[model samples]
Target: MNRLTTACLLTPALLAAPACALDPQPVNIQGLQFYPSLLLGERYDDNYREAAYAAPSSWITTLEPRLRLVAEDRNSAYRLTYAGAQQTYHDDSSASHLDHRLLLEGILEFTARHRLTLKAGYSRLEETASTAIPGVNDEYSLRTFGATYRFGAETARNNLEFAANHERLRFHDDSLVNAREERDASRLGVTWFHRIGGTRALIETRYEDFDYVQPDSPLNSHNLALLTGAVWEASAKTSGRIRAGYQRKEYDDDGRDGLESPMWEIGLDWEPRSYSRFSLTTRQAYDEGDDGADAIKQTRTRLDWRHEWSERLSSTLFVGAARLRYQGLDREDDLSSAGLTLTYQPRRWLELALGYSHWDNDSTVDRERFQRNLYTLTATGSL
Candidate 1:
């Protein structure tokens, strides 16, 4: 049998074996709890750089270890997690690298109905050259902090939330990408929600500011948005949210024109059967671009379905499409992707997964069109 066919058949056979020993449980030190996990995986990518022509394929082996710590009381909770990964490439040794991520989150209840949520995270990772400028592997560090406060009784019909977030992105090798692309962004928003029958009506307004490290950058801008939406729980089997709004961006440079676009987001989750679930999501927004453009207006839609095949086996299928239009240029790209993943968890702390994905891009610019495929097999164990 071919490699693909043999792999497909072997996965199910291994999962169908008798149950194995249970993994070690979490460890508790005083009031803090810790859970540790390790993941080993192999992935084959037909187009590692996502080049339009003459794509180079590679085989990658990954080793990841993660630890999570949590502490909770009657009115307060705290969590900290750290994950690191080392990846090795068979043919492309220069592309191998180590990645690290750290996240801290907390929730505090000051009063009976007043609560605050906070989160901070830092990550250092590398991305393929196609996703960035200069056509080389790019390494970057990202830091983010956010906080939200909610007021009103939990049983009340009305509530209000105020939130603020900040993020900074820095590149390690500035020669591969422009230092002007490094930026700091801040966002402040407020939301009010009122319960009406089984639905919650919400109105929100947000302000965002983007500042580039380079003074001569033309991409620095401020954005304002006003939105109204509703969240409905029609039944136990269906829940969803829909929001529509208008956004306006003002740029710092007079040579480039700003943009005003209609913004919207929608999401739905439906479970028609006990063992099956469906999800639908769509969004329209403006994203930062590293191609010396002001921004990229993007609209994307996705649909996902998950079903349980047996007690220890489940499968998920997803398809998505996106359209990206460069604000200050006549460039547009249409992209689509589809993927399927099968997972098996015969033991509480051991899991295996197999996945395949296909991606296609059609751009107005000829050099941006490409098709790619990926196959992955992973096994994870936790203690």
Candidate 2:
């Protein structure tokens, strides 16, 4: 839906929807619980357009209203959600837009050992000026469907999971008609887990196929990855997973170079105190390139710390760095970013947050380089 439709549906809901049920609780409708919420935010962006020179600043306002319906029984759980975010720029109307998403998911456990999970989602999203030609906003829609099945329960000695997913991407802007950006991608993967005391030793195999609708889709390719990982779930103070693997991506056009790279991912969380936590994550992976390259290899790492100062106040700090190596192109980029946020909840159903973030990007292509800072104030209300 567009901004008008979203606004029309959101106005009355924000004012009266929560009053439908009287007990300060979710309303019961058709055997499911209904939850409604709204978020309002105001932001000041120093570089809203992501310009490399003569950057302009703007004040932005965002409104989002969401509703969720959920049902759960002994054997199964199901949920449905819809959300729309509309953004308006005080100085740049051309940069304003509305984004909408819908999602549905269900989990079914027939027995203690067999479980099936399914999900599907659709998003009408916009690619802001950063990904476009500096002045254009690229619009696209995505539809995704996926399912996963597990063969063993938590206490079992071994577990097996089978997963499959498909995605369809379509561009809406006429400026992208010849860009050949529309495509379909499918992935199939399986993992085998062997329990080793408090940890699990695992191996995974994945295959992916990409298809483009444009004639002579030179970027069409098949990819494969073999990975081995270890999982140590929540324990006394620490939990995390590490995986190392190799991936090979071959393209349909022999003239264009392919990518064969080593990949690894690490994630860990430590709770040193009852009111504090620290998290670290790192990843090296490949993403399909739309910037005149076959693919891009990205490496990044981040660290975050969260502490609760009081029963109703909390703060978080984070820093990150990344590098991008574009395959089939001589361009490279280094990126650094940091952010801090403070949140307070004076009441159970209301929350407020203030945040500030900064980004610095250095690219071999001059047009892609920029530095930006943003400040925001946000509030959320729910019933």
For 1-383, candidate 2 gives per-residue lDDT tens digits of 11111222222221233322122357899888888888899999999767789987889999999787888899988888888999888888877899998878888999999998887878897755465456567777878788899999989989999999888877787765325757788999999999999999899998989898787988899899999999996587899998889988988888866788998888999999989999999988776765565677889899999999998899999999999887778889899999999988887788789999999989999987899999999888887
lDDT, model 1: 0.81
lDDT of 1 by residue, 1-383 (tens): 01111111211111122223225476999978777888899999998788898887899999998777878888888888778999887878877889898888888999978989888878887766365553466777888888999998766799999999888888787553446578888999999999998898999999999898977777789999999999999998999999899998988887767888999989999999989999999989777765545678889899999999888999999999999897666788899999999999878889899999999999898887889999999988886
Clashing pairs in 2: none
Off by over 4 Å in 1: 1-24, 129-135
What does the lDDT read for residue 291 in candidate 2? Answer: 59
The lDDT of each candidate is 0.81, 0.81
lDDT of 2 at 8: 25
Worst 10 residues of 1 by lDDT: 1-10
